[model samples]
Target: MPLRSTRVAIGALAAAAMLATAVPASADDGGRQRHVNHVLLLSVDGLHQQDLAWWISHHPGSALARLADNGIDYSNAKTTFPSDSFPGMVAQVTGGSPKTTGIYYDDSYNRALLPAGTTNCATAKPGTEVTYFEQLDKNLNSIDAGQGLTGLPGSILSMTGSPEQVIDSAQLPVDPKTCQPLYPHQYLKVNTVFEVARAHNLVTAWSDKHPAYDLLQGPSGNGIQDLFTPEINSRADAAGDDWTQANSLTQQYDGYKAQAVLNQIDGYDHSRSVKLGTPAIFGMNFQSVSTGQKLPTSDGQPGGYLADGVTPGPVLADALSFVDQQIGRFIAELKKHGLWDDTDIIVSAKHGQSPTVPAQLTRIPDGPIIDALNKAWNNAGHSGTLVSFSIDDDGMLMWLSDRSPTATGFAKSFLAGYSGNGNDINGKPKPFISAGLATIRAGAQAAAMIGVPVTDSRVPDLIGIAQKGVVYTAGTSKIAEHGGDADTDRDVPILISGTGFNRSRTVDQPVATTQIAPTILHLLGLDPNELQAVRTEHTLVLPTVG
Candidate 1:
C-alpha cells in the first residue's frame, strides 16, 4: 500500500535509507547505540509504580526486575484522569487526553449521534449513549466472540484483523452527518502511534481485552495489521465462568493473550499457524492484576493490599507473579528469536485500581443518584429522562437530556444536598455523603477540565466526583473500581527497557503516559510529528529516553 500523501516523501526517503543501511542503530544518551527494530509495548493494567517497586524489590531475580535493572523507570507517571481503560489506552497511543480524543469512557454519551438503529438521521433528534465495550461483540457470551467457526479459541486466534467480523456495526452509534454506524476508530478524533508506524510501512499488532480496542487503530482504521482481541468479559468456561470474578480465572484468561505475543515473537500470527513475520510494533494488555486488585476469591478471600495498603495481598501478589512470569516468557521468546538486541520493551498501565486500602472502601448504588435527578426533572415538567446517559465506576459522569445551564445547576444543587444510606458489597449498611460535590465539576467547569468547549455535545454537563473510597456499584463482585481522580487510579508505572538503556535508573521527574506515543515513534526512527495528537497537543518525547 502507498503511504499517505503527507508522509509519501518521508516514506520514500526512509525506504531508500533502509536499502542503503545494514542494520544501523539510533544513537541515544551517552552515545548508546539503540538498534530498535521492534517495540513491544505492554500495558499491565492496574499496575502501580508502588506495586512494581515492591515486587521488584522483593524479587530481585525476576524478569521484571531484570528489565528494570537495565531500564529507566519513571518513578512518577500519571495516566489520564477519569481514568477508564478506553481513555487511558487512547492517551498512550494518541498522545492526547480525553479533551483531544473525544473519548471519555467505553460508555459515554454523544449528543451529535443518533440512536443505534435510527434509520433516518435527518428527522430524528440527535443524541444517544455510545457503548463501545463488549456490547459490540458478535457474541458477548462466547470466548471466541461467536465468529461461527469450528474450533474454540483457535477460531478467535486466526482472525484476519477484520474488526467488522467481531463487532456488530448496528449496535454502534450512528453518525447523523453520514447516516452510518461509527466504529470505534471513527469515534477517535486524532491519529495514533500505530497509524504513524503504518505510514512508515511498519507492520503493527496489538492484543487486548475486547474487540472494542480496535479504537487503537486510529482514525485511519487500519493502523494495526494484526489485531487480536479475545473478549475478557466472555464466559471462561462452558459452566459460565466470569474471568474478572476471580484472580485465578483472570490469570487463565490473560494466558491466551500472552501466548499470542509469544506466537508473534516466533514469526507467526496470533494463532501460531501462519508465518506473518514478527510485527515491528506489537504488544498485549494483562488483566489479571486489575482483577486481583478489585475482586475476592469465590471462597471469600479478600483482594487489594494488606493492612498497610502498600503491600500486595496474597491474591494481588499471585496476580503480579503471573504477569511477571508472562513478561519473562516474552523476553525469552525475543531472545530465542535473536531479536532481543533489536527490540525495545515499554511497560506501563492503562489505568490503576483505586482505594488500595480495603478498609476505606464504601459501596453505594448509583441508581438513587440518577433516580433523584430523573424525578426532579419530571416534577419540573421536563420531558423524557433527565440524565440521558451515565456510567459510574468510582466517579459519576452524567449527560443530561436538557443540557441547559438551568438544568445542570438544578442537578448539581440536588446532588450537593443528596445523602442516603447504602450497603457495602457485603450488604452491610453505610451512610452516603453528598457525592462529594465540593470537588465535582459542572457546566463550564466540567467542560474546561475535559479540554472541550462548553458547547461541545460530548462534554458531560455535570461530573460528580465520588469520595476517595466510594465506589458506585452495589454488587459484591468487586471491592474497588477505577475511572476517578484518585491517585491510585491515575498513578501508574512507566518502564522503558531493553537495548538502549544503559543501567538501572529511577527518575523522580513527573511524566505522563501520553509521552509514550511520541517516544515510540522517535525510537523507531519515525517522525513523532506525524501523529496528529502529538502535533495538536505539542507532546514531547519521554525525557532522558528520547
Candidate 2:
C-alpha cells in the first residue's frame, strides 16, 4: 500500500465523531486563543545550532533567519549521547532517550538472550525492537485494514534499488518479499504526537529526508498518511540501476515530497471550509545538503575548503541554501493557501557533522586492551565471556562476556595504559571513563559492558568515552564523525512556532530532543505522562494550551 492513500480509521466511529467535536477550541471564554490546531515539524539533517544562529543572524536574507525572527527558538536544544541519525530522529519523535528507547546508535550491540560470563560477545546482534508507530498501530488496528497508504508506495519504489543500493551488503535484513518500510511502525514502542493528534480527529502528514518513512514496514494500525521516498526491492534491481540522476532522482524526489505536503493541504482545504482547518498537522524534511559526499565551502560558496583546509567544503553550504530555498517555497505555499495563521512551524536537525581535521585521528593499540581484558576474563573461568570490540567514530565500545565482574576496572586500566603510552591526542591523560556499572553491582557491571543496561537483561559490559575532537581511526578514512561525547554532535536546534505558541520568545533552558514528543503532546493539551517512555525531567511545559 502506498503511504499517500492510507487514512485514519477508528473502531468507534461515533466516539471518534464526538471526540472530534470536543477538540479543544482554539478560543478561550474571553475570545483568546488557547490551542494549536496545526503543527509543521521540519527536520534538517546535520544542522548545528551555532551554524543556524550564525546564518540566521548574519544572513537576514536566509530563510532560517526569517523563520527565527517570526518564531520561538530554543538555543540550547541538545540531542542524546551516541548521536546519530536513527537514534536522533527516534528521540525527536518518541520523547524517549537511548536509555529508555534502547536505540543508542545507528548500529548497536544487543545481547538479550546471551548467558553471563560468556566471552563470546562477538555473537551479539543489533536491535530490532518495537518503536513509537508500532504501538499506535496495535492500538488502532480495530479500526480497519488501512492499506493504500500514501507514503508506503513511494518508499517501496525507492527501496527497490531504483537509484542506488542504500544498505551495505552486511546491513541488509533477510528478504521479506513485501515492501519493507524504513519507518517500520513496529520498531516504535511509544505513541507519537501524530497518534495523539489523530485521536482528536486531526489530520497529520510528514515529509522527511531520512529513511524513517521509506523504511516503514508493517500494518499501520493508526491509519496515518505517510508520504516518503520510494525504496528499491530486489537484489537484481539493486544491481541493475543508476539511482543518481541529479534532476530526476534527487530534485524530483524532493519536489514529490513537497507535493505530498501540498496534496494533504489541498485535501483538507477542499473537504473543510477553512484552509487552516483542513489538515491539523503537516511536516516536511529537506536533505539535499547532507548528501554531498564532501563538505561545503567556508566563504558561503558551494565547494571551498575550511579555514583549516581540512573540514568539508562549500558543497554543504550550497546544498543547505538549496534546501533553505525549498523551505521558503513551502512557507510561501502555506501562506498562499491561507494556512499560515493556524499552522505551527517547527524546524530542527537530526545531528551535526564534525570537522574532519588531520589532528582529529587518534589510534589506541587494540591488541593490548583486548588481549588483557580477555585474559582476565578467561582466567576467571567466565566461559560465557563474549567480547566484541570495535572502533567507533570517536570512541571504542567493548562488549565483554556477561561474567566479567572487573569489566569497569579493566576498562579504566586500559584507558590508563593507552594514555600512558601516548596513544591519546595531545598526550593528555584520559580519565573518568563513563560506565554503566556506577549504577550496578559487579554482576550488573559485566552485563552493562556487554550492551545490557537493565538488570536481569543483557547489555554491554563496558562502554568507553573518548575526549572531544578525537576520532578513532581503524582504516583508510580520516573522516571526522559522530557517536562521541562532543557537544557538536550532541547539540541540536529546537524551534517551535504556531498558534498558541509564545511569539518571538527564546527559551534559554537546556532541552533534549527526547522531550519533543511529550512536549508536543503537552502543547496539544494532551496527557504527556501517559506515554510510558516519557521522561518527566526532560518534558517541558510550554506556555501553549495545556
| Per-prediction TM-score to the true structure, in the order listed | 0.92, 0.65
- Expressed as tens digits, the lDDT of each residue in 342-458 for candidate 2 is 666778876654433334434333333445555665676755333543324454444444434455565455444443232333344433223111122234543443334445322
Best by TM-score: 1
The number of clashing residue pairs in each candidate reads 0, 86
Off by over 4 Å in 1: 1-35, 298-300, 424-426, 436-438
Minimal lDDT window, size 10, model 1 = 14-23
C-alpha positional error of residue 261 in candidate 1 after TM-score superposition, expressed in Å: 0.5
Q: Name the TM-score of candidate 2.
A: 0.65
**Residue 73, candidate 2: C-alpha displacement in angstroms:** 1.2
